[model samples]
Target: MKLSSRRKAIAPATRPAAVKAGKCPICGKPQDAGYRPFCSKRCSDIDLGRWLGGRYAVPGEPVSTRTEEDDEE
Candidate 1:
């Protein structure tokens, strides 16, 4: 095969388009590569705070603390 033909076939496979990053969830701003989904450290901290502060909770049924033995007693 000619060098030019081989080059054309490999070029597309080697080169890929840049991936677009999504906006920050905490704030509506473009995401930074360093902070990932968050735009900055501030936003990242805010998200962490929310989780630690019990603001974000998982949905589930309440667990029963009492047993049948407790009722008998």
Candidate 2:
């Protein structure tokens, strides 16, 4: 009868059919809420590993490191 209780009884609007039916980017399976955009923890871990291992990189200008020896010169 209260406003808060009425709101709680209503279910959230569902996503569009395309979004709801979209496949996981990692393994081409339907995505799960727990691991959104990916199918499972294994796929999630694989993605994380790729990032940690530098397999995924952003495009940027190369940076040169200046060492103490270079400073001496």
| Deviating ranges (above 4 Å) for candidate 1 | 1-20, 55-73
TM-score of 2: 0.45
TM-score of each: 0.46, 0.45
Could you tell me how far off, in angstroms, the CA of residue 62 lies in candidate 2 after the best superposition? 20
Error of 2 at 28 (Å): 0.5
Residue-by-residue lDDT tens digits, candidate 2, 46-66: 878888768556556678797
Q: Where in model 2 is the C-alpha error above 4 Å?
A: 1-20, 55-73
How accurate locally is residue 9 in candidate 1, as Cα lDDT from 0 to 100?
Answer: 68
Which window of 10 residues has the lowest lDDT sum in candidate 2?
A: 52-61
Model 2, position 22, has a per-residue lDDT of 70
